[model samples]
Target chain A: MKFFRNLTIGQYVHKDSPIHKLDPRIKILTSLLMMILIFLTESWWSFLIIGFFFTVNIWLSKVQIKYVLRGLKPILVLIILTLFIHLFTTPGEVIFQIGVIRMTWEGLSRGMFIAVRLFLLILTTSWLTLTTSPIALTDGIERLLSFFKIIGFPAHEIAMMMTIALRFIPTLMEETEKIIKAQMSRGADFESGNILKRMKNMIPIIIPLFINAFHRADELAIAMEARCYRGGEGRTHYRALSFKYLDKVFFMIISFTIALIIIINVV
Target chain B: MFIYLENASYTYNLNMPFETKALDSINLSIDRGEFIGIIGHTGCGKTTLLQLLNGLLEPTIGHVFIDGVDIHQNKKGLKEIRKKIGLTFQYPENQLFEESIYKEIAFGPRNLGITDDLLDERVKKAMKMVELDYNQYKDRSPFELSGGEMRRVAIASVLAIDPEIIILDEPTASLDPQSHASFLTLIKNLYQKYHKTMILVSHNMDVIAELAQRVLVMEKGKIIMDSTPRNIFQESVEQLEKIGLELPQVTYVMHRLKQMGKEVNSGVLTIEEAKEEIFSILKVKKSNNEIF
Candidate 1:
């Protein structure tokens, strides 16, 4: 009961490895390139190539295979459901039939291809998150988006918001747990009710969570002001990012992979 | 008897890869008017244990009985049990959602189906219990109040239901000393005035020492010690230290004095008692000096 609901987003596991040491900008670009290539490839063989590269990269990251798999577990049901729907419901020549249910070879292959693509996409994105700290990620994003500032885009503000939101994920999770325990002690029955009743019971928990979240936001704003935070205008980073030789090599490999996938699809 | 957990144990995310045993097999009973202090380090199952007592969590291996009936046995009875045992979580101010403090306090009683005059009376009484002035604060939005005031309003919201037992989990966490002291006094008044059974889960030894008649110490999902506060602090100082808990300041001072060859009892828990003991020792030393 205490463990199932502790799912937190953007939690980076600290480790000393090649992937962890890579420049955040390179990782971000690699992730984006992989996502683009994944969408570009329509053939099965290219997926195999991409999957092979993904497996090797994950292995090199030195993260426990189990932790990456754990992140995948939450999305497994969605992937399976999507595959089943795509395989059986798409109109095509019947490869197999069971009463009203019919399966087509094309649909089956497409389903498998889509599932694998989605799986790799999620896994690669998770790898980026697992390896890079949130601060570094946002810093890279802010720097990348700074180009848009010339066109009147509020890139710095957006980046600041993202960083703060990411920073509060764990704090808010801990607070939510405390609030739930408090309401539970008050005899709020959240577990054993019909859908409506359960939702009704959640009023106690959700209300408190929102209240606390806002309270925290207010306090954070004041604290920031007290510390002379003037919204990313004159801010200097504690750790300025520098791209190394490994970053260059990593980006070059990603570019090569994308080119190969695109060339295969075109041919 | 109001609540009873018979040989209960709870594990979080059972059968999952991240499974953890939050509470071990334990037996506990709370009468209608008893105040129980549950003390433990972080992750020691104090919060889990509180959830069990109020039937927010059904025991994985045992049953929770409220008013001589198992709460999980029937839906109607479970609702009643929830109404009977009101829990105020630590930093409860987060739960305030209504537009006004009055409505926030009235929320619980309304859920329990009380109406009209009785609801108003309960709201007013609950506000008074927490030392909130109904006239000044009731019409105000809870969101506008300071952290301490919002916390009191949150507690008032729960008290409106007139629960027989109240459970507070680290009620004074992160508050200034003045606010903490005032909040403690408010809770003490609730115990004395209404005689409601209270279970306070806290890591603050001073709060527990001042409030709890009986203390339950938990470590690694097990109740390591359950006794009167005096007994637990005096008899198991070494064990408590091993579990990352410290005795109250007065008790620590008394223990140090005893170690330094002074004729002083180490069981004293409050500053007032320590003052009397130190004064007597000083007088004795002065008399010896004159005789010399």
Candidate 2:
């Protein structure tokens, strides 16, 4: 019955903790580094190291473990697909065979490795988003992308769009909840339908939602123009992003973790 | 049917960091054919209370009984309970999505399995109730209508279901004065002619005074006052002002006159009642002056 309740993308849970207090740039860079290193991980011991660090970071973040796990539910299908693809196709010593399908130790191990890697990758990225507000994340992204502006990248514009879209997620979610309740009151059965039937039922919801979204977009454009929102050539942020000593310390800790992970993979 | 909420409470985003208690220890009952008005400031759980009456939400702490039977005891018949108590939400026009007005109004009864001849009859009957011509407008798209007309169509959609009790959440919101008066009259007819147990949640004290026999004033979460409109308006001007609500225009005038040394009853809810009260008080004052 809850349509957008499980959606966690662009959701920021406010908590006053070290991870939440970390510089958004440092948190973004650390997440990117972890994503790359997780793919480079080839052994179960490496996953154990990554998983341990992840669990500790999550604990330090002060967000509920159950809430973080709920964000993982949407990607379960992808994880299962990756696991099965690795499990059945990889060439290895056969442990069991039925006709052309073979179960192998290598396949099982590779499947587990890929599953853990994907899980950790998703977990770290979501953790980055969970700890940082959308405005701060966009600021971090814009700052990082400014280096590429010499190559004619529209970094500020992109960052602004991203921030605006992220800001609308909760608003749109509330609107969708309203529309769903409206339809439900009219005896529109969103649940208890087959796949096709359910999609048909969703038509009642999706059309009105699109109309409202377009209307909102028009109103927002007018409001922005009224405020004289020109492109961000010389626009300065009200709350400027500055790197404090704590940001430097956070960067050092992440660099040390990355170095340890690389050494584990190489050795 | 009797509707009772016993010590009911609700918390949004329960068990999450953003959890909020919207309703708190609300205990109220409505007998059949009673016109009840619920008034409160924004976010004071007036909408939440309306949703609870028809089972749109379940209380986190207490039970909601419809005809002395707990509707949530068996989830199997919950839909049946919903159909029996029609709920037209605020800005109901947003619910219109069918291709034609005919199909739009028929959506509810069709879901209830009324098909063939009875469906047409119900759709036409509902449309006529809202003053829309079935022959001319049935094939027209609901989106093509004016805002006020579309609002009526959305309401007609709910009426097609023909429930025993109808709950409207601010039905006249955002309408012009002319349309607002007509809409209230339409609701009045529905209440008087059909004897349906109507529960209206409105911010307009005048509308509540004009229609509701019983008024339930909500503050924060609980019902602070539940009594006749006369009793509620006559005495609670100061308390209502403290809660960010104002008395009806007529009542406010009478209240001001009473403060200015006139022996006027401050519970007048309409312009006509205020005029009669003023005239009676003026006549009595003249006779006393002549005797002196």
Candidate 3:
């Protein structure tokens, strides 16, 4: 029934904070660097460092811990699967045996380590999206991708598509809820069905949603045309992005964190 | 006592940072076979109230009792309650999906586990109810029909359920004049023929004036006024105007004449009544001039 409420992923939480004020390009770059750091780090101490960095970023972003945690709800199964896979399968010194299944210390540590890494990786990207508005995020992506324009890359087009997609997420979700409610009013029980039955039930919701989306797209294309919206060529922005001192400071802090993680890995 | 909202309140995204109280604690009731129209400004919680009425949304506080029992108390009976009150969303055309009109209209009865001949009967009945010829439009793609036809098909899909109370949210919105009039007529026929408890939500004062026996005016998540449509459109002209709701054309004309110091009844509900009121005054003037 509630689709938009728990939708924290790629949703910008408007809050008065330094992270909110930082340039989107800097935030995007730093998020990317932290993701690489999360992948590279091996030692448990490195995880603690990355975890601390994420906790601080979440705090600075001014989004609630609970809101950020909700973003992981969809992937909770995958995280648990990774942890269990390592625990049951990784060969190591057996701490105990349950009918040919060994509970090894190495397996447990490895599982915990991998789980933490995956969690931190998700936290990094979500933090960027949470703090930065979708428009700014697209602008950042466009600016970063503009470098490839030398090879005739469609950076602006790509960014525009991403911007539209992100902007429509909540709208589409709300429409989806309406369709479900409308169907439910017709005695359509979406819940309490076998998986295949539930999936088949989705046909009623999906076709409407897809058709509505196409209708909206067609209308939007005409609207843009009526407004004389050409491609991104020679287009200027309404909100000109400027990398201020705050963004520079934030950039340096993240760079320093990344260097520290890299040095820790080398050691 | 048929359907009641006792101190019901609904808050969207409850406890979240973006939480909003869409409905304040309010008490209301609807009798059987009553045609009630709910009108309000945008974001005034009209849709939210409709959702609460049909149990699509559970009130954050208080209860929605249907037939003297709280509907939310038994989760299993929600579908039954839904079957009792059909809610047709605004732009119901967006909910139509089946490849053929037959399957689309049959969706509701089919969901209730009705099958084969029984389902076909319901679909045919619904199609006929909407004035869409069953034999002509049954096998045709709902998507291929015109906007108004698609709208009717969508509504037929809901009517196929044969709910005791049918709730329409902005039924006449975004329709051409012909379709709007025809749609209103269709609703009127349903009320007269079936005696279903008809609940319609529309911002159009004319629609409310024409149909609703009782009108509920909502503001800021609370039902501010519950009165007959005539009383609401006439007695509360200034207040309704202040709230940015336009009175019906006839009501507005009558009110305007009254404001101009004319001897006319400002409480007229229809154009015919307004015309008679104005003619009465003209007759008085003509007789006065003759005496002079």
Docking category of candidate 1: acceptable
Q: Model 1, range B57-143, lDDT digits (tens) per residue?
A: 878898888878988888567668778778876667766667888888887788677899999899999988998887998799998
iRMS of each prediction in angstroms? Answer: 2.9, 1.3, 1.0
The DockQ values of the predictions, listed in order, are 0.34, 0.55, 0.76
Q: By TM-score, how accurate is candidate 1?
A: 0.77
Question: Which digits, one per residue and each the tens of the lDDT, describe model 2 over residues B110-200?
Answer: 8888999999999998887788899999999999999899999999998899888889999999999999999988899889977778999
Off by over 4 Å in 2: A1-19, A40-105, A148-152, A249-267, B281-292
Docking class of 3: medium
Chain B TM-score per candidate, please: 0.96, 0.95, 0.95
Per model, the share of native interface contacts recovered reads 0.50, 0.52, 0.85
Q: Best to worst by DockQ, what's the order?
A: 3, 2, 1
Best by TM-score: 3
Q: Write the per-residue lDDT of candidate 3 for residues B202-256, one digit (tens) a residue.
A: 9888888889999999989998889998788777877887878888888878878
DockQ pick, better of 1 and 2: 2
lDDT digits (tens) for residues A130-200 of candidate 3: 88888888999999999999999999999999988988887899898998888888888888889999999
On residues A95-178, what C-alpha lDDT tens digit does candidate 2 reach at each position? Answer: 888999988888898898888888998898889888899889999999899889999999999998998898898898888888
Prediction 3 TM-score vs. true: 0.90
Which number leads on DockQ? 3
**TM-score of chain B taken alone, candidate 1:** 0.96
